[model samples]
Target: MFESAGDVIKPKGDVNAPSGLQSVLDVEEAAEPVLPHFFPDEQNDSIPRLSRDTFLDILDGKYNEHYDNKLIIDCRFEYEYDGGHVDGAINYNDKELLASHLFNSPLEGRTLLLFHCEYSVHRAPLMARHIRAQDRTVNAECYPRLNYPEVYILEGGYSGFFAEHRQRCYPQAYVEMDAAEHVRTYLRFW
Candidate 1:
């Protein structure tokens, strides 16, 4: 169906649907960017996944020993983020904004990225991959080199992390995207 608009999110037969951002002035359906569990090795993915405990380590300054500079990215919608998230995470749901943030930051190794959505299943992984891919495109001359080489994703995502490490979260409340209150209170406006 996305044949004419560059097919950036081409699906291979029926097993998967590869999605990404390709802004061309609203000419077609804007599919959500979701990275499937079985992302092919061909896609530009060299990012690492971290467990909840390890994520806590990073937050507590145990992982980097000094905590230098780390960026926790919560790629959830505004309402879900306002509901509750990692204390310092910035709610940036757009891929382009994420790429801009990563690309502009100097390659100092101090700014580590911890990207996650409600499940780390689709949204978060896709955004991380997008930034890495953009890095590759611009860094082609400097092959095998990336602006922010080592970015990370939280395994089990915030849902699992919040349950085990409630103290670490700010406000410590979890809100699903399709919560009844949200649907009744806000979705009608959209």
Candidate 2:
């Protein structure tokens, strides 16, 4: 059995015992914590979060003078991304590929990196944790003279952003779907 405390899912049984139970665990023991999807009960101070309006402002060049570089990564599935996504945002469905892109890409000059998914709850946080864990290695190799960019997750994900700035979205066909049907279809994973 499993019990959910905020975003962390805890096993009801002895998870540490040497048995067949290891594979079932979703999180591994590590110094840096890995967060689950955001629930009303979960409170984490490590992962920085950005509001939808703030993100929109950034996109509108509100912070252009302050931030020299910026990147918005959308971590949804290919189809969901194909359906609709933020302008200029890159789609990276696989975590491994995202990691590789971060490692090989030029990010030292960047000042901000924003990550988001359908709900800005689970996948985004998970990816942020992964990047934080690998920060040291990336800095050593990728940014020898520069500093790491400030990373943040969209507080409500694409859903929240879309709710507020529907005009900014692309692929009208996907965004024009029936609200109820769209929710049922896209949010089925939740």
Could you say which candidate leads in TM-score? 1
**Every model: Cα RMSD to truth:** 15.9, 16.1
lDDT of 1 by residue, 1-190 (tens): 4656556665457654434533344333322222212333544655667877677767777756533567889988778888898888889888997787667765464456779999887789888889778977986655555555557788878898888887777778998878887886446534
- Candidate 2 weakest ten by summed lDDT: 28-37
lDDT of each: 0.72, 0.68
- Tens digits of per-residue lDDT for model 2 on 1-190? 3354643665556776776333434432232212222333476646678877778888898777766677788888666677888888888866778778777775555467789888877888888777766665654433322234467788988888887786787764234223564677657655
Candidate 2: misplaced stretches above 4 Å?
A: 1-41, 140-147, 173-190
Which pairs clash in the backbone of model 2? Answer: none
How far residue 3's Cα lies from its native spot in candidate 1, in Å, is 61
Q: Which pairs of residues collide in candidate 1? A: none
